[model samples]
Every structure is written in C-alpha cells, then in structure tokens.
Target: MSEKEIYQRVEEWLSRMTLEQKIGQMIQTERMSITPEEVKVFHIGSVLSGGGSSPGENKPADWVKMNDAFWAASVEEDEKHLPIPILYGVDAIHGHNNVLGATIFPHNIGLGCANDPELVKKIAQSTAREILATGVEWTFAPTLAVARNNQWGRTYESYSEDPEIVKSYAGAFVEGLQGDLKTDSVIACVKHWVGDGGTTYGIDQGDTDISEAELRKIHIPPYIPAIQAGTLTVMASFNSWKGDKLHGHKYLLTDVLKEELGFKGFIISDWDGCDYLNADFHQTVAQGVNAGIDLFMVSEKWKPFGESLNQHVNSGNVKPERIDDAVRRILYVKIKYGLFEKPRPSARYWSNHESFGGSAHREVAREAVRKSLVLLKNENDLLPLKRDARIIVAGKNANDRGHQCGGFTVAWQGVSDSMDEESDEPASKITTAYGADAGVQRGKIIGGTSIWEGIKAMSPKAELNINGNMADRSRHDVGIVVIGETPYAEGMGDIRQGDETIAEMATKIKGLMKVLHPYGHSLVLNELHPEDLEAIKNITNQRIPAVVVLLSGRTLIIEKELEESTAFVAAWLPGSEGQGVADLLFGVYDFKGKLSFSWQKKAGENFRKGDEPYNPLFAFGYGLSYSNNTEN
Candidate 1:
C-alpha cells in the first residue's frame, strides 16, 4: 500500500481504540518491568534500555529474545495497526557504547577531533548495526550541542563551541543512521535543541543566559544539518534559550523550529522536562502542550501530564488545535518510520547472531579509539616511549576496567571498582577498550607488560611493577602515573567539583614522583586537574620534564600547566582501554588527536549557575603532536 494510506489505516485503527489504548501506544517504558503481557494489556507504543539498563541475560542472542518479547505483546494486542512496527530507541552516542562487544566509536568530542564528516558517518553506520541487533530501530543521538564553556560538566558531549563544526558533524551522523534506514538502520534523533550546551553555570537543566542572535550562532548549527538529513526525531533541550524555558517557549518550539526551519519529525522533550514548565513541574503538562511539545518522555506520571493537558483543553488554556497538532506530528513520525505497516513483531525468540555486539564491529570500534587519542604535548620525543626503558605504572586509574570504562557505560555515573557487585545484575556493558582484546594494548605489547599479570608471557628479562601507592617506588627510566577524575554524569560531575577527591589518594602520586625524582624519570600525568599543578609546579619550573595526560570526558582550564608543564595531553575517555594509554606512552602509537572542545578558563568572578561567556583559554579542535607532517 502507499505510505499515506497505511498511515490512515493506523490512525483509523488508533481512533477506534479507547483513550487507554491510544495512551498505551504513546507510552514507552524502560526495558525493566517490560514484558509481552504488559504490551498486550497496556498497548504500549515503544520500549528502551536507558544508558546502563540491560537484560538479565545480556548475550546478543538473549537481547533478541527480550526485544521480541515486547514486540510480540504490542502486536498481539490489536493486530490492526498496519504492517509497520513499534519503534525502539537507544543512546548510540559514539557507536553503540552502551552494548558490550559493539564498536564504541569516539564520543562526539573525539569525533570533533577527527573533524572528518565522513568518519562521523561511518561511526554512526557501525553504531546502527549493533543497535539493530538488539531489535531496536531508533537511536537518540548525534547530540547537536554547540557547547560554549568547557566547565559545563557535559563539555565532552559537545563536538565544539563553534557551530560550523557541530553542524557539519551532525549532518554526517544523521546521514549515516538514516542513509538507507531499512529494518536494519535505526532512526536518528537529533537532540537538546537550541541552547542546551550554553547553560550559564553548566547546570544540567539550568538556564542559558544569552541573546537570541548569540544563541542562533553558537548553539544551533548542528540542528540545521540534522534537519537536512531527515533525522526522525529532535529532543528539546532541558535548558532554556535566552531567558525563556525551552520546554515552554512557543516562539522557538512552534514558530522558529517548526515554521521557519520546517522540521518534519516529531519533537520529543528531554526526560522529565515537560514537567518543568515555569519551574513548577506539577502543572507543566498544560504549559508544555501550549508550548508545542509533540511527544514527551513521560513515565507513570504520564497520566498527570495527560490529565493536566486535558484540564488545559477544558479550560481553553490549550486549543484543541494544538492537541491535534501534537498528536498529528507524533503520528506523522510513526508513519514515516513505517511503524504502521510492519509494526514490530512481538515474538520473544530469534536466531540472528549477526545482531547485537559482535566481533566485526569491534575491529571498527578499535579504529575510533586509536584515532581519537590526541597528543597535546611531547618534549625530547618523550612519547612513543623507548621500548627498552623500564616503565612503572601507578595510580588507581591505571588498570581498573571499571574506571577505564568511564561513565554511562553499564550504569549512570559509574562504579568505583571493576569487580561486578552482583553477577545476577546485568554485567556492565562497554566497548572493550585497551589491551589485546581491543588493540589499545599495542603499547602494553611493546612494553611487554600486562597490569593483570604484572609481567608479560615473553618475560623479556624485564620486571614490570604495578603500584597503587606512588611512594612504594621501583627505580625506572620513566614513571607513568595514571591520574584522573572518576566517572560521573552532568549534575553529579558538577557536584563533585574538580573531581579531585582522589587527592587523599594522590598523595601517593606526589610522594612517589618525588622519591623517583633523583633518577631523571619522566612522569606521565594522566587526566589530572589543573589546580593540582601547584603541587608539581616547583618541579616543572626546575625543568624536571613531566608529561601530563588528561583522561577526562571534558576539557579542564589548564593555562598554568600549558605554561609550565613538560607536555600535556587530552585523552578523551577511551572506554575499557587502559592499554591505549600504555601504547601511546610506550611509543606504540603517535599523538594524533586534536582538542574536541575549547579548554575552559577558570570560572571567573562572572561565573554563576547559568551565565556563559564567549571566550575560553584554548580554542576547540586544539591538539599538538610530533608527527611527520610538513607544511603543505
């Protein structure tokens, strides 16, 4: 049948159903508590596995069964909605980072480093395959944030402060995901519209204090390219634009984004954002409807949103036309994805080994990890360390898989240690980073060392010392002290404040670096804070060459370090790849990555919870290297 006719069929079918049935179709729940029976009873529309949410049996084959279970229930409920399927969604930011064995490409920040639109496209395509394997057909990704301040806990989430770069990259991601969106290709959702990354104080969902013109320039470019690519969905920003809330700003939501740009897809709000109208969530349902939000990521509280919406309609606070408009847009997106004709199957059984996280994808994922590594500083050819030099690896961050994986891996924020708390709980899923399993171990191979075994199989007549305490030192040619902030998400990251709580622990690094000082040893400072510079400044000024490496998801203000350090590096979070750091430090790899976002300046006197300035210490896309490149 023609597309429009099928849409009509679904809409007609929906019209015949009860309000409970329609609401059920609009509802999407977390994979937890979701079953085929729930779908048949609730007539649910969609399902998702939020960042760390996974199934009891996480194997690829098992995932297919779980997804099929949800699909089976929804289909069996009505059997009237056309051949289209129920849309499934995932946060496939930088490949399918959430799923184990799937290729985890560079984060958007790292993608910014490559600065290649084509590379971005390929990464998205790789991400789509894994997403499809789990039986999901929608992806909430290609975050279109033109981040301004590096201090924003989510700095790593933005590709750049410059709009041009964000836009170019966004287009590439959309094309890759929807290039030929078949049953295999997942639909892309361009997100957090307008000024999400411009929050004044970098609060997660705080205000963005800026003029309209500035907002348009510094923060809105990515969406333009996203629109051109026919991205299936656009999640509204939790942050506001200028002084008005985005969730309630009719001007930007309806007038500008819809009327001006002509976005054809549905507009989904950030989680729980619809309840944030006028800063009073309890009554936001009516306000959001009047503001033009199409589909809200509402949960059990959805009935409140619906009830408030109903009240607004009764009170004439929201016109019926607006309700119809929102529902039509929602219906439009469902139809566009061919959800009406081939509605997702509801059988909890499958046989596709190719689906879900697998081997071929890991090869592609490793390339992203390698290329995204940026070498910020190199003196006396310190990097690509001498294969023969004795190397001592220190710090809690050196070899723990849990810390190495970074945040948003198998849980929100992240666990402190690698050992699974409960095997019964789903194992934390992540792209295998570092070591032999992921090629990040190239450096470890050169050094003939493995943190787990404390030495290599080859022996090489070498003693490899792994020290959690810096003071308990072993004489070495080079001391690679791995340091960095532990994992946390946006709001939690801000709460942690510089992520230097490891200070009590870092006394060990300070003590050990000093004890090893007399040996002319070079220290590899991995992902450390700039404030900690004072601790090492005296040595640095004495020209005691030290290489500082950053293993953060965001950039830090490091003017003092740049001025006094031997060298500095930005190692964007390489998931489960401690070996990547080893490879680069031991000379197995070259410093090839550039800065993804601007290096933040210390929040000065003007810094507040929601105020942002235009300038920063280091510009976006900044990186240095001792590569063999001559000026063309």
Candidate 2:
C-alpha cells in the first residue's frame, strides 16, 4: 500500500482501539509466559520466543503449529475487540539459530572479517527464509554494534569496530531481510541503538563514557544506513550513555532517532529494559513511555506492565497523544508489511519449506565460513595441506559443534556437547544465572558437522585425538589443533582478573604468570581454555607441522599459542558448516578473511584502528591467502 493508504488505515484502527487495547498493542510478552487464550483476552500485540523458549520438539512444523495457534487467538473476532494480527519475533541473529536444523551462519564478527556486503546480504536472505519456515515474522538481528573493546562478551555480535564497515553492511542487511516486504521476508530490527559496544571496560550493559561527537563517529553512523534502508523497527540499547539509561533518554529516543533520523517504524525496549529505568514499576512505565518507546518487551511481566501503563495513562502521567502515536506507528508497520492481510502462519508461502537448512542454505553458510577464515600466521606456508596427508585433529573445539557456533546458538548462552551430562531436573528448575546449566540436551542442541567430522569427511586418514595424544607421532604427517573460547554470552563472557583460580591459571599456562591489567583485571585467553595451548604444544613439540585454527568470538591473548604453531587461522565462530574450515585446509578454498578487530598482543591491552600506541600483534585489515602473501 502507499504511504497515504497505510496512514489512513493506521488512523482508522487507532480510532477504534480502546485505551486498554492500545496499551496491549504496546506490550510484547514471551510465549512461555502467556497462553494463546490470554493473548486474545488481553489483546496482546506481539509475542516472542526468548532464546531457548521453543514449542514441543522445536521442529519447523512444531513452530508453525505453535504460531498458528497464537495467530488464531489474536485474530479471533469478539464483541469488544477488533482483530489485529500479532507479530511473532525471535532472536535469529546468525541464521534461524534458535531452532534446530536451521542453517547457522558465522557470527557477525566473522562476517565483518569477510568484508563482503553482498555475502552478508545473501546470508541475511537465507536467514529470513529459514525464519519464515518456522512461522516467525520478525527477527532481532543485524546487531549494529561498533565494538571497540574485544573484552566485551558480545563483541562477536558487532560487525566491526570501524563504522565504515558497519555502515557499508547495514543497508544491505536491511534490504536482504525485508526483501520488498512482498514475499519471503521478515521484519528487520536494527538494534541496541547507540553505543552498546563502547561500554567502560567492555562491560555488557555498562556505561559508555564518550562524547556525543565520538559516539556519533564510532557508533551512530551504522544506524543511518539501516534507517535509510527502511528497517521497520529499532531495539533500544540496554546500556547507558553518559550515566543516563537509554530506555528513559527522551532526547536520543525521540529527538534524535524518531524526529531527526525520520525512523517511521516503532521503537522497542529490550527485555525488561524499563525495569532498569526506575525502582518503582509505575515510574518505569511512565518514564519509558514518555521517552518515546513505542513497544515494551515485558516478557513474563506483560500483564502487570499493561495494568501499570493503564494506571499511568489514566492518572495523566502518560499523555494520550503519546499512546496514540505509539499505536499509530505499530499499526503503520503492520499494515505496510501486509501482516494484516497475510495468511496464517501455517499457510504462508515459506511455512515448513523443505529447504529449511537444506544443501543450498548450507552452501551459502559454507561460503561465508570460507570467506571468514583469516590466515593469521602462515609460517613456512604450512597451510593448504594435502587431502591424503595423515592428520591428527586435537583440541576441545575440534569436535564440538556448540563451541564452534559460540553463544546465541540453540540456547541463549549457546550449548556444548562437552557440557556436563543433562541433569534430571526440568529446564524450569534450572537457574538462568551466568554459569548455570539450563539443562540443555547437548546431543540434540545443534545439527552440523564438527571440525573433526568435516576434516574426516574430506580425508579418511584423519585421526581424532582430542587430548592431543601423539603416542605414535611418526604415523601422522600433520596436526590440526582447533582451540579457543567456549560458549558464553553477555556478562558470563567478560574478561576479569579474579575469575580464575591461581592453580587453574598456572596449569593452563605452564611457566607464564597471569598478565594483569594496571587496574588488576586480566583479559587473558589461557585461563578460559588453557588446554588449547597444551594441545598445540603437544603436537608442535613432537616436531609435527601443526596448524592452529582458533574459533573465538573476538580477539584474545594468543601470543603464546601463536609462538608454538606453524600456521594459525582465526576461524571466528564458524557455525554449522565445519567443512568450510576443511575446505581451506584441504586447498579447495583460499583464506579470504581479514582482521575485523586488531589482534591484541597482550592481555588487557585495548586498542582500535586509530588509537595511539596502537601496537598490535597484527594490524587491522591483515590477512593472507595462498596466491597472495601480502596483507591487505
């Protein structure tokens, strides 16, 4: 529909909605919190599947069935209600990652290293298709964080620290995700608006203590292109700017984003984001609404939030015009995307499509993995190993799919096959704390080939010895040691000084003492997985030409590991398609990824492209290929 037509419809719907209904339109609840009947009775506007919240069995058909029920509930006509379709959103960050069998793509950090906007767009396209197959209409993806510090746990979510790279990729990602809004598309949400990656000491949801000029230069540039490309939604950041929480920052949320940038779509609060604004629930609701958040992702607290919002509006705290404006924006997007006219979830064109995680999608993911593998060190040209060479694959990450995918995979913090055996306790009984196991069935978490499996598929002579046991080194021609950070997200992945025990630190790094920052914090990688270095040493010490493939979310302190390897490749969280790593090792593909972030030489050293004293192990944009030895 045209702009005039959409506006007319929005106004018409806005006129018909009651105050309670309008407030309902502004609230989004988690699927597990409310029943389908509650969705209809409460007139809820949106529903989402939080990271691990899935339907029975979590298959494509199961998702469709679940979505169909909710869709039916929302549109069921009644005397006091007007039917409005509810938008279903999920965190399909890297492919439809939350669902089983979806083709998981490399995390944004790896995509940034690939430095191909077209390839990123293709990945977005494939991601949208897979999400549609599962009956979800919206995906909270294309995280536009200009991550300055690698110590931040979510550095992998950022495309690049350089605004130019993020700016170049933003429009392409939006275009690919939205896709004309006619067919095979999902609503794109360009997220965590403004400076989520510039937090102090790389703390997630911490303060960004930068000047407005610096914030615009380093962070806000990416959102301009995303807005220009017509992203239908923007998620407010959980972090604060200059000690002010963004959820209640009226100037940035209203004056800058909606008025100045001309963002026509609705602005959404992150999960329970308003709760961070004030101690009182009513005050939080008032502040958030007045600050111009169009929708609130209240999760389980939707009912209480809705009731509180109603009281606030009735008491003249939240203006009725503001409520109308929020409703207008919501209706405008719903109508513009044809969500009102679209068929039920099970009847949609791509619903339960056979190509969900099929060969074609996996091929695109493989290409991304191949393009994203950065050849950090090719000492003596040890890479491009012969396919028939006898190989010994070692390291914990070598055979683990969960570690390869990293965080935000099947679960919120991601899962590992090597994680402790499933507890008999129900998933509900498990705590959602930082390091707590959420009772994930590791065996059924993901569907993909491990690095060892991929290598073995190409070369039958490959042997799997995860402990790096070289009982007979003479039989092996080469060793492939895959190592790096395990699965973690947000605060759980932060680099801190006191996290490791003294004995644990010593055992991980034999003679080297833990490198502490001037402030007594440590950003060392050895403490996280010291076994990685041990495996590398075990192979290299035996005089085997070892190739170290590091699978991590961001750059880590790897000087010791690099010193012991013949060749090193930064395979930054390559998802699902392990064969892509094998493709490069076996000479089927060449290394193309460059350093999206500068490689840190030591623990606790934070440096960017233009920072002073910018000595790094390898400079930004550095990579090597078989044909070209020169760095870009």
Which candidate leads the pack in TM-score?
Answer: 2
Off by over 4 Å in 1: 1-20, 33-35, 77-85, 278-282, 307-317, 340-352, 417-475, 495-547, 558-567, 577-583, 586-589, 600-621, 628-632
Query: Candidate 1 — what's its lDDT?
Result: 0.57
Q: State the weakest 10-residue window (summed lDDT) of model 1.
A: 512-521
What is every candidate's alpha-carbon RMSD to the true fold?
9.6, 5.9
Query: Against the hidden reference, what TM-scores do the models get?
Result: 0.78, 0.94
Tens digits of per-residue lDDT for model 2, 1-632: 78999999999989889998999899998888888999898889999988777888889999999999999999998887779999999999999988888899999999999999999999999999999999999999789999998777889998888999999999999999999997788999998997999977676676787999998888999999999999999999988788788888899999999999999999999888888775677789999999999999987889889999999999999999999999999998899999989999999999999989999999999999999999988877787898889899888888777788888887777877542223322121211322335564536445568788899999999988876876256898899999988777776676655644333433322122212222124556576677988898888778887899999888888878888988889999999999899999888988888988998888767779998979988899999999886685
List pairs with backbone clashes in candidate 2: none
lDDT of 2: 0.85
